[model samples]
Target: MALTETPLLFEFEVVSSEDLTFIPMCVRFNLDRFGLRISLAQWQLLPYEDRRLLARFPVDDDTEIEPNFDHALFEMLRTHANVEPEWFAPEEAPAWRNVSAVPGGVANQAGLADLRTPDIEDWAQLAPFQRYVLAKLARKPEANHDFVPAMREFGLAVPRNAAR
Candidate 1:
């Protein structure tokens, strides 16, 4: 399938035509909401089709319906990789969900990258998925070269970068 056919996949994430070496933010976002974690090794073990399916899986947010993502992913892991899925407690209040303020990590990273920091109004305007993507990109454990690209993609004005 063409990469664009996978709506959750972003242009910045297209490291190669078909090499999904890194987990896309869309998969991460859904997994985070479901409170499950899959290792990179585990992800690589799945056939490309399954990886694409997981990336395409929808976030089940309807309170009135039973959520199936956790079970489906678990089965996929068990069937494909012969391993159990790891778990984490989902955040009671994820920073991205709080539109009242921009997370400090994101703001700090923007400043460090010499990009315009998003204010509350800007933050509020972002779709939840966009906010989630930003929160993940802003994390400091690694050098985040994608932050500028992501900001530009999300319609945020990033000035010329001194850090690039």
Candidate 2:
């Protein structure tokens, strides 16, 4: 049987930076529980030109729906496909708040003046990264450009202007 034909698979967009020149980019993934670990040396092994070229996303198929990485194929191709988990952005990784950054003025960043409401429940229930963004916005009220947008986008904040 074929590989994509199998069941246990899923996908998500992975944002990354080789951090070389700072041209932001993204990659598509067809994921499985089995992991792949790629190294900078492995990446560097490519010809310098090839390395640069590979860092770029293919324009023709810019938004590809990658097939789930089939386990059978993974088992068959494990030796050749030493996939690395390095490509995923920290945002996509488990949400780990940067303690040193000190985002919010108070402990409950999401419960800020504009963000909070009687309808809302526990602020601590939010994901750490979600709390971090809101916390940062709360600290520098001047940087509230995305404050309402972030809140509404995440479905966490009900607009003060909206009628209940």
Candidate 3:
């Protein structure tokens, strides 16, 4: 099926439920890229139905949507909805390509190196999504501080920062 590109009507505010704070840079990037200009109050006021609809539709290539929204909203709305978020690093993400095969790029770099061991049979037990998230997080230098904490929370092994 051909991918249908849709224009956005409502601007999104990148508010962190964890912090109750908005990341202005991320917000501006989404707005400028998607042609949206939504306020915090406006976002809060949106009915669940409308939010569900917006989340189901595809934005342009440059826009960023909430990760959970990308997965849950689309899957709930339509079987054919493309649920992948723009932030998702592709299989060939730079970090994955650059690291040695032994390290295996992002997954290894992110402290999930233990995942690569054949002797540790449990390593193969992680869900694909967990593996994907771990790999993506490993390659992102910006997420380094949060990566180990997230790994612990997710029951993944932590990697030491050799640079420190």
Best by TM-score: 1
For model 3, how big is the CA root-mean-square deviation? Answer: 12.2
lDDT per residue for candidate 3 within 50-143, as digits (tens), equals: 4434433432332344333344433433433322223333333322222233224444345343332211333345443334334544554443
Q: Which residues of candidate 1, in runs, are more than 4 Å off?
A: 1-7, 16-18, 59-66, 160-164
Q: Mind sharing the TM-score for model 1? A: 0.85
Please give the range of 10 consecutive residues that has the lowest summed lDDT in model 2: 6-15
Q: Cα deviation of 1 in candidate 3 (Å)?
A: 19
TM-score of each: 0.85, 0.30, 0.33
Top lDDT model: 1
List ranges where model 3 is wrong by over 4 Å: 1-103, 106-120, 141-143, 158-164
Candidate 1: 10-residue stretch with minimal lDDT: 58-67
**Count of backbone collisions within predicted model 3:** 1
When sorted by lDDT, best at the front, the candidate numbers are 1, 3, 2
For residues 27-123, could you state the per-residue lDDT of candidate 1 as single tens digits? 7877888778989999888888777767766544331243555677788889989998788898889898899999988988888877768878889
lDDT of 2 by residue, 93-136 (tens): 21224433323343244444455542323345555545544554
Candidate 3 local accuracy as lDDT?
A: 0.37
